[model samples]
Target: RIIEGYDGLGIVSTIDPGQGLVVVWVTPDTQDEVTHILHFFPRALNY
Candidate 1:
């Protein structure tokens, strides 16, 4: 659901959501933006 609003920022391709195995793909240019966005999550998801 997170990636739904931030389409160009990143993508989440997880075969099994229950396993908590979420694959996030972010390009080099989008790294800073991704990091900034993740900060709002209270470090719940760290790369």
Candidate 2:
């Protein structure tokens, strides 16, 4: 899903509700991407 900020700056993050896995696209918005992923999956991490 695409998550947009209050200023419209956003990133695309995919969340697998069934598997409870949130996949985030890392590029320009690496920080935003991670934030988005965590927003969807509070316990998500690379490890």
Candidate 3:
């Protein structure tokens, strides 16, 4: 939800709901922006 809020940034999908696993498909040229956003998120992402 948070990642998707950023336009042209990325789209997140659930890989395993039970394990809280998900994937973020980021757009080309937006890696830095996405990484920055993820860094400040409340929940830590397992990259």
Candidate 4:
């Protein structure tokens, strides 16, 4: 929901729910911003 709040920032997609795998796609212009925002999230296994 937090990422959803930002317009055109990025999107989080579930790749494998069972393994808790996901992907985040961010706009080139918003890469830095997205990186900053992502810093707040808990680090995932093998990330």
Candidate 1: the clashing residue pairs are none
Model 3 per-residue lDDT tens digits across residues 1-47: 88877887987899999998999987669888998988998977776
List, residue by residue over 1-47, the lDDT tens digit for candidate 2.
34444334444455777876655444564666456645774554662
Q: What C-alpha lDDT do the candidate models reach, one value each?
A: 0.77, 0.52, 0.85, 0.77
Q: Please say which candidate is ahead in lDDT: 2 or 4.
A: 4
lDDT of 1: 0.77
In TM-score terms, candidate 2 sits at 0.30
Candidate 4 lDDT, tens digit per residue, 1-47?
66788978988798999987777788779889977877787764333
What's the candidate order when arranged by decreasing TM-score?
A: 3, 1, 4, 2
Q: Taking the tens digit of each residue's C-alpha lDDT, what string does model 1 give over 18-45? A: 8777777889998898778777875477
Better of 3 and 4 by TM-score: 3
Pick out the ten consecutive residues of candidate 2 with the lowest summed lDDT: 1-10
Q: Which ten residues in a row have the lowest lDDT in candidate 3?
A: 2-11
Worst 10 residues of 4 by lDDT: 38-47
CA lDDT, candidate 2, residue 19: 75
Residue runs of model 2 more than 4 Å from their true location after superposition: 1-10, 28-44
Winner by TM-score? 3
Local lDDT at 35 for model 3: 89
